[model samples]
Target: MSELDAAVAAALSADGHLADLLPGYAPRPEQQEMAAAVADVINQEETLVVEAGTGTGKTLAYLLPALLAGRRTIISTGTRTLQDQLFHRDLPLARQAVNRPVRTALLKGRGNYLCLYRMERTLESGRLENRALADGLQQVRAWSGRTRSGDLAEAPAAASEPALVPRITSTADNCLGQECPLYSECFLMEARRRAQEAEVVVINHHLLMADWALREGGFGEVLPQADVYILDEAHQLPETAARFFGLSVSSRQLFDLARDIRLEQQREAGDAPGLSEQAARLERATADLRLVLGDGMRTAWRTLERPVGEAAEALAHALAEGIAALAPQAPRGKGLESCHRRANSLYQDLQRFLAEPDEGGQVGWVETRGQGFYLRLTPLDVSEQMAGQRARHGRAWVLTSATLAVDGQFGHFLERLGLDDARTLALDSPFDYPNHALLYLPASLPEPSHPDFAEAYLQEAQTVLEASRGRAFLLFTSHRALQTAADWLARRGHHQLLVQGAAPQQQLLDRFREAGDAVLLGTQSFWEGVDVRGPALSCVMIDRLPFGSPADPVLQARMEWMREQGRNPFATYQLPEAVIGLRQGVGRLIRDASDRGVLMLGDVRLVQRGYGRQFLHSLPPMPLTRDPAQVRAFFADQSSTSS
Candidate 1:
């Protein structure tokens, strides 16, 4: 091994640097192996994909190498929660262990920061809709006066009202940049400046994608300067990249534009008669488009019926006319010019969204949320685009996640990420899964499509909950199923049922933990990123395999495209996706070496179907059982052992 590799190995050793510095630290072979792999990737400047299972200390493994190499490293996480945790917790600890003063900056999307200009405008406009929002704004005003970072997460009142964050933050479309009076003190700009100068930068996948796509100016250029790019929760990259590479225009965006134009006209045009009328026309046109799309409808744009397409085309024409009416007034002032630019941009985006062809590799879809509608053009495959991006950057890339591999193979992830030549490493979690966990696949349950499957699944879940004393997470593939099971469980009064959407996800999790032995029912969101250790979460019941819904516009388009290419969509796309999701769900069972629990898969297909072995193999090694008596015995054994 090289000197650098030896140093990394020693740092990860039992009595090495981290152990000596970190309180209550215990070294593990998996973490050491992952650290060595990361160090090699940094030294060689090669791409590496690693599946460091839960409890492997993957964050520290990657951070140590980056700090030791003293290179500009950009670490991107899947969620802001993880981003904050890394910047505030993991990075500080690693810095302490390494005994190096590495400059680190946490940069989230612009929406997370307070925009003094926007905040002032919002307050001055007297547009506060309610007392709560008004109070939140006042709180933010106070925070803005004192905050050095201007991050909304640090403002308690702003954090309480999530809907108000967007109103107070500046987006790319609306930011006045250097022309604005507040440019000197702009929070987002300062954050970007710090990031550019820092040795390590922490960001979420959204910002990373925006940077890769080169969506903005100065800030978008941060990634190309980094020597190493470490992506935690790497599984989310493919989906996030697809979004960033796509085109989208929303009804809300149009409404916001119209509102801004009116405000600007009042400031610049000084009672501009034609402009106000045109703005109103645009708002009405947007509402008409929303009505045409209707609520809860998601369908491929090419597959939309004639009337809907015609309505969309008509709305696009109205937007064009509105932009034309506003264009001649652009020379008036900065505010009016901003509005004109925004209007023209929105109109062009609408045209592109409506006219863009799928071309066999893209999926064009329209979806409606509440009263708003969105037209989206998403790439069916982002691999080639991502590969082109990687080649252009020529930086050392390290991708790590607990659920990146299937059946100990990285082929699925590597192919999706366009990292065919990347070195691969799979580290089994240090947790004693076989001894501490049991994989309970219930037998004789009806197929998921059967009319009686819901009752049968609920019955089996209740059995598991009974055996585990109501400490369980009942995970369903759809909200409909979650609601059905939640309603059934509530009526039966079997356990303390905490349903998703009853409150915010965090609140639900807090309640679940506090209840100690409650049963929590949730859908896709609960399948991953949820950590509830100890005996409080003794069982996890999955209703069915988490296959992407065939009715979903994006999934349907991708599957159809794969079929046109003579590929088995089920094997190539669907199965692997389901396996990864299942792994995430099952991983919630064993959080630590001492944690013991039962993972109950309610789908009978696991034993009756041939593909069952793939799902079983993808999970952590654990003793399998079909009989409920075995589940009871496992819990009993756990109780006796703990006693």
Candidate 2:
């Protein structure tokens, strides 16, 4: 082994320093093997794609190697929640265990930091319409003076007073950059400077993908190029990448532009009546466009109703009028000049959507959510763009997650990111899954296509809930199914039911743990990145095979693109994606060495369909049973042993 490889192995060994530092430490050969692989790639300056299963202590397995190699590294995670956990909890613990004094910095999107110039401008405008908003702004103003990092996450605004977030934070469209009077004291700039100097930087996939698409002028401020990149939760990277590698116009962007113009008019263009009137007209036009787009619609541009096309034309006219009025006010002040530039950019973006769909893999589509609508010109596939990112940055790369492989194969993931030549590794969890868990598939449920499928699944799940008591997670493939199940359970009033949209995710999770016997119903968001050990979460029920919605505009475009290439989309694309998703939802059970639980798949297709064998081959080695009596007996044995 090379020097760095040896160091990582020794640090994670049974008798190493990490043993004493970590409580309830359990040494597993799988973790050591994974760490050695990571270290070898870092030393060789190569790319490594790895999947380390649950209870493998993956955070430490990759973290120790990155620290020992002593290279400038960028550690990107799937979400801000993971970003904070890695930076605050994992990084500090690893540093103390290994005795390394590495310089570390945690960076997030620009919105997370407090912008001093924007806060001052908001105060000067005196636009607070309520006492709560004013009090929240005042709280941030007082906290800003003492905050060294100005993360806003660190500020005392009782969750940063979310209502004042837009008022206090700066966006790329409004920021004046080096021209601002407070350029030297800018929080975002200072954070970037620290990242440039630190040995290791923690960021999320959103910012990483944004930087890869550096020209859009979104949150695409390129981070300091690094010697190494370690992307944890790598399964989420492709979806995040798809979002950034597209061009779009949104109702949100149009409304925000109008609001900014009004603010700039109040400050610098007070004498220009035409400017403010045009801004008002732009907002009204945007509202009309959203109305015609209709709610719950996501389809290609050509398929939209005729009214939508007309509203887009009126919107274009209103936007042109806005640019005409703002052109004369461009010389008034920096803020006004920025607004003028933004109005022109927004107009150009909307023109792309209004025109015919462009060639070269570009798929024009529109989606309306609530009162907001988005028009996107997205590439059907981003493999070429993703390949370019790997070539541009990092001497060494490590992409890892719990669900990167399906049926012992990495072809689907590698082909998606154009990393076909990268070395791949899969490590099984050290926990004894065979003895600690059981897969309960009821033979009685109807097809997921049936109209009464939700009702049938819940009726069958009533017995499993009784066996495991009330601690269970009812995972659904669609929001409609989730609502149906929630309504049925709420009417029963048997257990403390917590629905996903009823509260914030973190709050719901916190309440679930404390309640110990509550049943939580959730959709896609609850499929992964959740951890609950012991009997508090003894059962997991999935209502259907988690497949990508055919209604998704992007997915539809991709399916069309695959057909043009003469490829079987279902076997190659959809099946693998669904397998990984099912694994993620099933992973919620049996988290620790002592943990025990049962997984109930509500869909009968797992056995009725031939492709079900592939999913079985991908999951852990847990005994499967179709009888409810076997499941009840397993839980009964556990309860008897505990008593």
Go through the candidates in order and give the clash count of each: 0, 0
What does candidate 2's lDDT look like per residue over 213-242, in tens digits? 873454445588799999999999888887
Q: Candidate 1 local accuracy as lDDT?
A: 0.85
Alpha carbon deviation, residue 277, candidate 1 (Å): 2.2
**Candidate 2 clash pair list:** none
Clashing pairs in 1: none
- Superposed by TM-score, candidate 1 places the C-alpha of residue 23 at a distance from the truth, in angstroms, of 3.9
Question: lDDT of each model, Cα atoms only?
Answer: 0.85, 0.87
lDDT of 1 at 135: 86
